[model samples]
Target: MAVKEFKLPDVGEGVAEGELVSWLVAPGDRVEEDQPVAEVETDKALVEVPSSYDGTVEELFVEEGEMVPVGDVIISFRVDEEGEADETGEADAVDEAGDETAAAAESEAAADEASAEPGTADAEPEPAAADAEPETPSGRTFAPPSARRLARELGVDLAAVDGSGPGGRVTEADVRAHAAGDAGGADAGGAESDEAPAPTPTDVGSGDRKSAVRKRGEDGSGDAPEPAGRDTTLATPATRKLARDRGVDVDDVPTDETRDGEAFVTGEHVRAYADALESAAATASTGGGSAEPTPEPEPVDVGADAEPAASDAAGDAEPAPAGATEAGGDETSAPESGDETVPYRGVRRTIGKQMERSKFTAPHVTHHDTAEVDALVAAREELKPTAAERGVKLTYMPFVMKAIVAGLKEHPYLNSELREDEEEIVLKKEYNLGIAVATDAGLMVPVVDDVDEKGLFELAEEVRDLAARARDRSLKPAEMKGGTFTVTNFGAVGGEFATPIINYPETAILGLGAIEERPVVRERDGTSEVVPAPTLPLSLSIDHRVVDGAVAAEFANTVMEHLETPLLLLNE
Candidate 1:
């Protein structure tokens, strides 16, 4: 049999190392190609690594909780053929060496070993020391080094009699199972250990010492501990400093009693204390004491350009010219200027970088259109009750998606992306529309694959599932990639119209605004009547370098027309 070493792959942009959070398969377990072997945690996200080949796991090079650098062998597999080893190794070595030429092969191997075993370096020193003994806590023995370290970290006594590893040796798996059982209250002994400490009663009438005093003596007490000072009261460091500088006694600041070990003191407590102190001072000032001193306002200095203009009479300088005064006011009212700081991590950061690259590389243009969707609204209201009864809540988004798909069929250029470096444009035949979903963490665009092939109901179901997963942060990396075009619904947040930034690499992004009832003039033969119609405001942001302004406007108008009629979308 051939042993194939699987090195950790580069999952995202410039990720150096990833922590092995979980192992899906143990040594000797059979795995299929594309099956998840381990879950790894990078700086940005947690991702599952899949097996590249079908084989039996011969050895694990890394242990959970240990971090391994990219290009390090994490696991070895026993494969069916020996001939394929040379070819696989050469290709894998080339792929791993990309963008990481400085890392030596031996260093890579050492990283792999470290990933397979946590604290491997620290485990060797004790074996060489003559007087060193195995420091297994009284009760548990026969545990592997990894298991022993895990137990110590988790506060588990290793002397317990259960073992699940080969030859009755305790493993990390066993420790984890025990921890799970303890958490679930499945063990009565473990539950007893979790009980609260009993209270001690003080002796009343007798001259006997308290149990605490006796316990303190038994514990070998030295000098008495210092009493905590008034700094324990509720207030931020800034607030405390301000009070101290103003000669305010913090002890006089009344605060509500908090539970022992609580991490925070409420802001209400500080405000109440401040209000009480202010009231007392006001009363003292009103009761014939010296009045509160008035503070002087700081003076402003205008620049030379903003100085008073020369007057004809040379006396008043023409009252500093109206424009100079206005200019000074504008400078004072100007918003605080600073760099817009954003974390270069997670989905939002990735999106920001991609957009920056796209905008700088490709020229952009935008188009706007309005659609009167009175019939579409009527159709949706007619279907809403039936859809609800069938456990589906129909929204305007699904209708808009259908209209967009129809428009793409007629004007396929909107679904194409340009490669500036290659000097070529790619026209995608398949319709994979990415629906931009906003979550608390960031924005994620999960593609609704093969949108042209799927029916409206199927599209709606897929959109719902992708949106829910995006919100919960359960979406995989693959779900957010490979999109021909993108759609973002700003209507949900009550926006009338907005120009959404184009999702990078994709040529364009369609923005949907709120559907409002607006007055429309309906003409019948020779007369016209004012009627309320459901109207939608839409904006399309496109790369002007790839597409012209007219083409962008045409595509948007096509989408709007299809949405307004609704029947055109169905037939298409």
Candidate 2:
């Protein structure tokens, strides 16, 4: 058979090597062209490598988990050929000529046996039988010896049992089945149940020792078992030391709650557990060293009028209430109320890297503006019933996106990129608006491609799909990239104003703050009366190198005007 070697190819971006995660096929398996042969992982992402040619696998040169460089031979395939190897001294003499020739001979021999029929190959030569004792190359006893003994004892038919043992030698089970007269009905189920019993708890410990003994006997080496009671929970070396110092059980802390299946424990969870323990200890000490303290009486349910009077009295107090802390403390420490540290991986890691790159690369300049969305709010209220009938829950984001698209159309410079080399600025023709979605996996900005073409309803649908995919990590790299501008909604979290960092290379990002009911002067017949209008605070950060103060201000003004007159966005 003709053999062809397949080498690893360079995937992309000048990657030198990749870890072979798994092989989809094995030796002797026939593979088709372009079929996935193996999965590989690089530093950036995981990718599947497909087979180059259609052929039967003759050899596997590299094992899974091996780091293979580009252009390195990984696998070899065999195609049906005309001639067999010459069974003469010529081939042997040529093979013994060099060390590489010896390796090739061994590989060829292995490949031959791997694709060989039964009772073939010199490497696995016949063993010695009891009668005529034909000695095997490994100097081991053959299965025929055991089969003869078993056949005589069980009174089985020698010809009835199919010989699958080495060199077509019959095994003891085969002889037993032959003698049973019902060889076809030998009860394969019963035979399986007669297998070695499951190791007991004591046997498990002994099995470990036995395994060590076998290993030592085989290779004369091993590592010792870890200390008893040491938690197996994954934590950083520094965090483990902190846990030990604080006398905390790392296993009891639930840092993985925020991370789903990720096996990582955080320092914050350790600290919180320690705090809880300290609090419990102090409470116990205060209660005359008792482990259990007296329970406080449940509050009596007051009538509605009485409850209002009590709340009014409490609201009138000058000093801050018990357990209440200053707002500044919330930023540094855990929200005195409740806080959590999500593992910095997955989408969170992506967000962190993108933000870090954006902030460092782009010279951000933020311009703040407020929009009186009184008419927009009125229009939304009017459309609410119709929107409900259409089975779509209308939100401010769609309106804001529509308005932002309108603004971008007016000032196209804002919807462009700054060149990395600081040579030239390329204004993009397409407007791909990326909405920063805050999910369980932190912030993920998924782009809405060609936003200017999509209607408000269509944009809402795309936004929903993007948000869902972003949360599930099913978004493609292209979906997250090539955004001309970004929008982060801090309004969901009740923030009034925030200067969002430009999502780098892109010229600017817009932050939508909480829409609140604020008093506004409404012009009525040349006079004005105070009225509660829905007002939104917006913060726009642009790359100072590309967009100047005037351009940013004009963009902000245009966006504000669109939001002020909601129908203008619909018309545009």
Candidate 3:
């Protein structure tokens, strides 16, 4: 037996450090090689860190929510090396392990992808074939729906299996390969020539439901009381939070799906249950003489108003700022009425730093305008059904994207970046546009490659797909990169004509305000009349260092022309 320390590997793209989100494995827990042990969030993504060697976890050095630098020893394992793979094989394992943030499948694939090294081109896997795969965004594994269902049926761990499908998706075939014990086929279908590891307590509902409480309690800490209906319910942490937020006991939600002999509860399940209760209450109220059952009282979180004392959670908690406490105080107290202190780290921190840099480093100028979009509106209505037939929802976004591309072509400065080190303005020929998506974590911009080549229906489908994944916190790092320009639709959330910020490095960003009916003067055949017309508001922001005020206004005009005339887009 030997003690081996597994350091936090550099999850590519030059990431120097990551904040430990949670420990998937605890001390004394047995973990297999390539099994995800912890989830770490870099500025780029939240990814699962896999164990490099198979062993009993001796101890974890880093606590939850702590920032750790690359190559720092995170966890130590007690391994019996007598029959283990050679040192060369372990090095290869280390490289494959750092591949992706266990990103969720793109709206349809599985919830696990390869660890953080982005881009499609993979370097040749080391000669050692049986060593590794990739792991997730948040804690959810990215696999297709079918692949997820299959893994549950086969009792296979998706975390241990490398994704072989597009965007590092773990397919059903890959699951089968792992189950069949053929580690030699890992690159093509993430597999290993060993029996599946027994289900650990960290994996909720993977075993007997009778062990529910014991299973969820990691180190006997942070475990809330399980409601009656929830005893046999299996759900992700996000799903549980959703249930709690909606005041629904997960146990009360009915699920027809069961994995490993336990009921599988999802966000959709909780929502449907909530809706049913609402309907029943309404029906009872209308009856006047009602006998419909009342829902059970929501479980009270006794610890909700209080955070753990600094003394109690010293290893995990960061020390209070000097001014945050009275002299010699050992804790940071809260208000009697329950004041919340959300951690200002992770994705939120990343957004702050990026915004700060852009605001301070570049001079910004915004150009706002509104185009009469009655023709654009009518054109969408005409083509909506055709798009629908192809299973796409035709929104005004695709038209706006097309218009932005046309504008970028006419004013190339809007699509160019200032290379300060080279002292040059770098112009890009490809039209990869990033569409800003509002997610639960924060705003993420998923780049749609080659916007100039895709048709309206294709754009609509792809945009919707990316947005869905973005909101669910499943977008890949690659999907978020390589944007020559960006578009933000504040209109979707009911905003109108606000100055938008440029997505720095890239020279500009186009903000779309709500399309509303407004009275405007129309001069036709020597007659003028004030008429209500649907107008789309546009706000274009540019870096003053790269694009001038006049040039920005000219680009906005080109965009408005395509939007107002509709048929003008054909000239592109």
TM-score winner: 3
lDDT agreement of model 1 with the native: 0.58
Q: How many backbone clashes does candidate 2 have?
A: 1
User: How many residue pairs clash per model?
Assistant: 9, 1, 23
- TM-scores, all candidates, are 0.49, 0.49, 0.57
Best by lDDT: 3
**Higher-lDDT candidate of 2 and 3:** 3
Better of 2 and 3 by TM-score: 3
| Candidate 2, pairs of clashing residues | 156-179
- On residues 1-572, what C-alpha lDDT tens digit does candidate 2 reach at each position? 34556788876455676666677765445788898888765433456788887766544545465566677566765544345353211222223222244434564663333322122223221111111221121222223323433442233434345767755555777666554666442333444222222211111111001100011001111111111232457655445644554445566554422223344554444544444344333333345343344232122221111111112232221111111122211112233235653334434455678789988888888999899998888988887787778776777888998888888888888988767677878878888898988766567788998887877777777898888877765566567777888999998898888879888878989999999998888899999899988899999999888889999999999999999998898675
Which RMSD does model 1 reach against the true structure? 21.0
Determine which window of 10 residues in candidate 2 has minimal summed lDDT.
207-216
Estimate, for each residue in 1-572, the C-alpha lDDT of model 1 and write its tens digit.
Answer: 34567889998766777767788875546789999999886554568899998876645545565556787667776566643332112223233324234432444542332211121224332222211321112212455435644553343544452787775667888888776766543233444334211211001101111111111111122211111225556444433543443223444443333324322222223333333333333333345232333111122232222232222342221121111122222112122454343334445556677778877876777788789998889888887887788777788877888788777777777889887679898888988889988887577789988887776667777899989988876777678778999999888888877877888888889998889988888897889999888889898988887778888888887888888788777774
- Candidate 2 wrong stretches, greater than 4 Å: 1-347, 384-391, 420-422
What TM-score, to 2 decimals, does candidate 3 have? 0.57
Against the unseen true structure, what C-alpha lDDT does each candidate score?
0.58, 0.58, 0.65
